[model samples]
Target: MGEQQIPDATDPASVEPEPQRGLSRRGLMGLALGAGAAGVALGAGGGVVGGIALGRDQAQAATDAVAPASGIHQPGITTPVQDHLHFAAYDMMARTTRDDLAELLADWTYAATRMMQGLDVSATGAVGGSPEAPPDDTGEALGLPASNLTITFGFGPSLFDSRFGLEGQRPAGLERLPAFLGDDLDPLRSDGDLCIQACADDPQVAVHAIRNLSRIAFGRATIRWSQLGFGRTSKTTSDQATPRNLFGYKDGTANILADDTAALDENVWVSASEGPAWLAGGSYLVARRIAMLIETWDRTRLAEQDRVVGRDKAKGAPLSGGDEFTAPDFAAVGSSGKPAIDARSHVRLAHPDNNGGIRILRRGYNFVDGTTDLGRLNAGLFFLSFQKSPDSFITLQRALSTDAMGEYLRHVGSGLWAVPPAPAAGASVGAGLLGA
Candidate 1:
């Protein structure tokens, strides 16, 4: 959590560039221009180009917007939730060295700083560079505002392998998550060596961030799996309204708020006393690609739906409560002599009070990827949470294993990552661990 001066952005000494690839500068520029023209032409018939161009113009007309890229903690963790998200997991190539990994982080940090400020990745930018040279940035976001973009990076347990001589630097608590009941996890989408979370108010801005970063990692890393999400399902700040999930129920009604510093320190940030000095102020990220069985849930009666969630759908209030934020009277009796809120309801089972008083910062989003092979809608919540320790999540999930709501949900893809503290003003992410 110590502060240090960041290198001057104008000085090329701040970050080491990757070795040039086979494409000559002139050839790269020519190819890039050709691609740009083709994209414009493709958008011409639908008026897409005009629309986006207008959007860019409008964005530029406003005052420049920015999100601080450095602080005591990463921006995306506690920053107000954005409307769109682009989450990607990557695997480092076998031949990549420790130096390669360190340089990549530094380069990423520099680019992130510029992008967050509404500038291009490098001085050459998307256009106006040498006619033959490859453009430093993809031009899609050329006319867009910063849209409060924040890019957060994390290291998975797999990254601590012999390949990078980083085996000893792994945090003692970083490990593959334990399997839970009813977890139908797919190995292909389950784990990765590293991950990046790009969030912004504009969908295009979010996509562009991930696209450019992936391009930067060309030989050193390859994307394992990625997800695009919209309609944020949770709010990190008190000012934002709680968003709903695919189930049509308001989600994250009682989530941790950005202004709740005390709760955040206790539940989200790791202290130096926790050990692994490098992770101080850092947090653990848990992502679950949960697929909702809409058909089954749709067939159930409204009464049963309310019972399953232990809340009134229309009001999002506890069945035995006064309102949305009212404490659930778990012991209240119904007119029929049964417990008002069922003992196995999701709210009761997953409540922190029942799970050793642990809470997590939820930053999830809703997703829909067309239809499944069986003709059902392939839709669900991309559940994301950050916590001081993985055990907090582990304990809460174990209690939910037997919750009635589990019937309509399936855990397909999963990942756990160690999110390091934010870099100093001039430092790149992971600088502490990499000793860059």
Candidate 2:
């Protein structure tokens, strides 16, 4: 990403090609006119061919994208937010020993490294393995590119209670989140010993990573709950535009950017001086599956909706007036001579100015799990945030207890996990914590 041009997605060095190349006749034209492609794509004669060329460019960009498995911090938290997510929580199998937990991480790290590079899970992959037994790799991702895949691991509060001699090392603030005012949390969908967050530009690539990782953990652990999300709700870099939630409001308008090192240190990354040594440079992750009542929201008047969010529905600007990025003028008065932004509005309550300058990096997604029994769309924001300490999130959430926007939402699934820093290359994730 620094200076190198993206290599082709189908390059032999990056991916093991399948027996058949999945290309259409129009795709052949895109490959033929590769260099001066854009102008030709928009040409009068090239209608559908133009669409194919655009698709080609996106694929090429994804293939060239790769987040290293080893870094000062894990990749997904601060990586440019991918388009899709496959998040799963796992409970360790009964009678499993500490060694089993350590080995599971080692196996996951190895496979993640390969998949992130657009390679198979192992050298003897799906087709290359023996014909009798199940394949090492799930052959689904065979001809696909890496799609900027990242797999992040985290440990939950329940995992540290003397089960594996980790009780003494638990971070002071690492506990199950206290119940908030509007929580209708489902026990089945909440909490696990471990969590894996897999994100990628391609849905298939994201799903394949989780499927393969879960396969690797077959004996040691099993999935407790999982969620599939599309249309990322937050961005980790400045280049991305603010995305809208199901309520049709642009969310994460003030999210932390990947390049803000000072902000990262202050708000996102855990410091060794502030936490257990093994968790240094890592962050705490809070996952809340918030269900939005879009039908009810859709029927609400436009003016009422604007008042609830404290931003103009059309421009996403502060009610006090200015552009979308303008800092809110909480003190400004409306024509009626009242405070322009309502005190109970979501914006004013969640702002850093009002919360003693608190901020968290958000990398969430929008989810639709199909129709509920009542025949309403079961859809909402799969809210995910990373912070140095869980207290930052708790404080902000408590501040939003009276939020007018909370009326249209429900917190159905929740989990809090302490994300550890990326392991050294070729080392198991959480090795430092395990003292392995």
Candidate 3:
């Protein structure tokens, strides 16, 4: 019943891991690297695009608490939102066939499974693999524990095109998101054919997951865009407190809890009755990179800010009055002969009471991307939401079209993806859809 632990990087007990079924690789395993191999790796720089040493030593995952990776659902979706995230979008290579895609998923699932269990992608990790070739893992985390890592994968709308012969299997509800009110979308950062969301308590672990995965995808797929985020803006468990967004407002205060199976089934999981059998138990993932205009909002009066969010900034309580957890009394009126909570307030607009009882599971984070060229702080919220159908998110977003808070926000990037269920043991992700 005690917590499971992984072998240390230098442990002699470690041995080579078998390749997942149908996963054939070029390099040999279990051959120790020599001084010359070390020398070669030292000369290599971190950039894979350049001809440098990537320091990719496929070693055991040095981690602390381990997060279970194999389950009915993908790990990061309902798992307690981690403290850091490394999210990347990828596009399948040109002229690639269905087999290529399936192989890629198989490889990814194998590596992800190992990493989540606090092991390297392969058994002969880091220095244990043939030293002549590049290491299977990027060795930055050799001594680090898994740090409760979770890797979640998603298939974007583009992947369902004729190229994969998945057109007929596309769900009726899966499509590109409609244009929102204040969208200033960046084409380069917008959509992709696939995406991977890596989250962990330790930032390096999250980054390491994506780095290794991207390396695995060298010939088959390329990264479209990626984002690093910290300071979770939402929680999936009741034990976690409501985290704040860049705006300093407590975000996702009424979010669905991890233990609320009833709500999760209703709002997050796609049921068999929903159709498109391949994605029956999965959910739709919607990501929006929302750039917050803090300078403008900072200049606004405090009282006006409360009116905009319909909640007291300090207590995170409804302006109509109660504690942080108190449901907003949207019907209450202020002495000014108007509703206490502004008509366009975010709380009222996004509340399930106002949105036809529709709710989405949020897993967002605050981001500060250094500074803009103009010297202003480049900061915002990386909003992530999971729902049974895309329509739920679209409806909520549409209701916020004229939100008073809209004046201080701009959505720069967006993507909608179908998050498939976790693969069964020894099977790769999307095996159901790929017929693997």
Candidate 4:
């Protein structure tokens, strides 16, 4: 396969064109297994965000990365970018290997840095937006390969030492990891050790970068993990969709929308616990994670499952309407007097207040990697969402956790961060949130 293209967000016609096919398989395989290439200095490869020049120096420092001396072999199975992709996995550090996880993470950053160097780069959204624009395609708009990219990184508690081992005190640097901001590519956050995510218009390039980095990290790290991605259909397109997670449900229904006043305001916050004034333009507090329970979930009856979730299991439509978010007629109950949607269904339980309402913008993807003890695993969504407060998301999840929906679901991994808002002109990524 050449490259599976990412679908466009706005006018589908505006997406990238496509990549040329057939890079000899034998050559690609050899490159995949070849030794690491000489290191190349990594920096902003000349890109702009919101009309501002994100300098090469700043970009390089943001990721603390340098390009790979050489590239890897191209794979035939180029991943596709769907509406969303999600993934979930047990943390290896939490289970057994705690001390060596850092080395693994270091390698992850290194490999990822290399992979990104090969992508079609551009910046699509303003750090905080829903129905986010795919990678910037200014290059394509100008009749060149789309070059915009958006990469965000998140570190879960499991990545830290305290959560990794049974010992009383956490290993050094693990605690500090939470405060280290890898690449301040996102507008909302600028704290945390280093969690680097790079996006590009070409799905093949993006997938290769991610998988290569992840595989490199796996080679050195001691954590059990999973990943979800949206690869481009071809080298030319930038349109991308989020993937679904193991639960089979589009997981990010509760994320904050971008470019919306309500969303921007909701994402803004003040907390002394978060450091520095330079972090003002940022929104540093987002809890991102993946939950997997499909095996258990798949066993439930479709009708019963629909009732429990308050939506058509297959169509994802609300009890009374056309689609997932469509208005639901709560009064439409069955002759048996049972609510058309169970009173405690995930949806019903989540949006208990018809007036106050619950809203979350979900950005997730689907994934299928290696086989597990259970069987061959199919995973996806890189479950991510932004909320004004944990209370909103928590209240809803708490309800689901205790209800029938919780039976088949399991919280496999979690990552919490203080995401700062994007900065204004001539400012660093989190200038506003950091009070810079």
What stretches of model 2 exceed 4 Å from their correct place? Answer: 1-62, 68-70
lDDT of 1 by residue, 1-436 (tens): 4544332222333323322212223223323443110000000011010011112222233324555433477779988999999999988777778877875676565555556656665556788688677776887898898898888889999999888877888888899999999899998878898888999999999998877777666656778889999999999888998788889898899999988999999999999888477788889999999999999999999999999999999999999978888988888999999999999999999888788889999999999999999999999999999999999999998999889999999999999999988775434577778776
Which regions of candidate 1 deviate over 4 angstroms? 3-63, 68-70
Candidate 2 lDDT tens digits, 266-322: 999998788988988889999999999978999999988998999997888999999
Candidate 4 C-alpha RMSD relative to the actual structure: 14.2
RMSD of candidate 3 to the true fold? 7.9
Ten contiguous residues with the weakest lDDT in model 2: 38-47
Single out the weakest 10-residue window by summed lDDT for candidate 3. Answer: 35-44
Query: For each candidate, what is the lDDT?
Result: 0.75, 0.76, 0.76, 0.36
- Write model 3 residue lDDT over 244-287, tens digit each, in one string: 88788888899988889899989999988885777877899999
Could you give candidate 4's per-residue lDDT for residues 4-63 as a string of tens digits?
Answer: 222222222322222212112221221234322111111222322221223343233332
Q: How accurate is candidate 2 locally (lDDT)?
A: 0.76
TM-score of structure candidate 3: 0.87
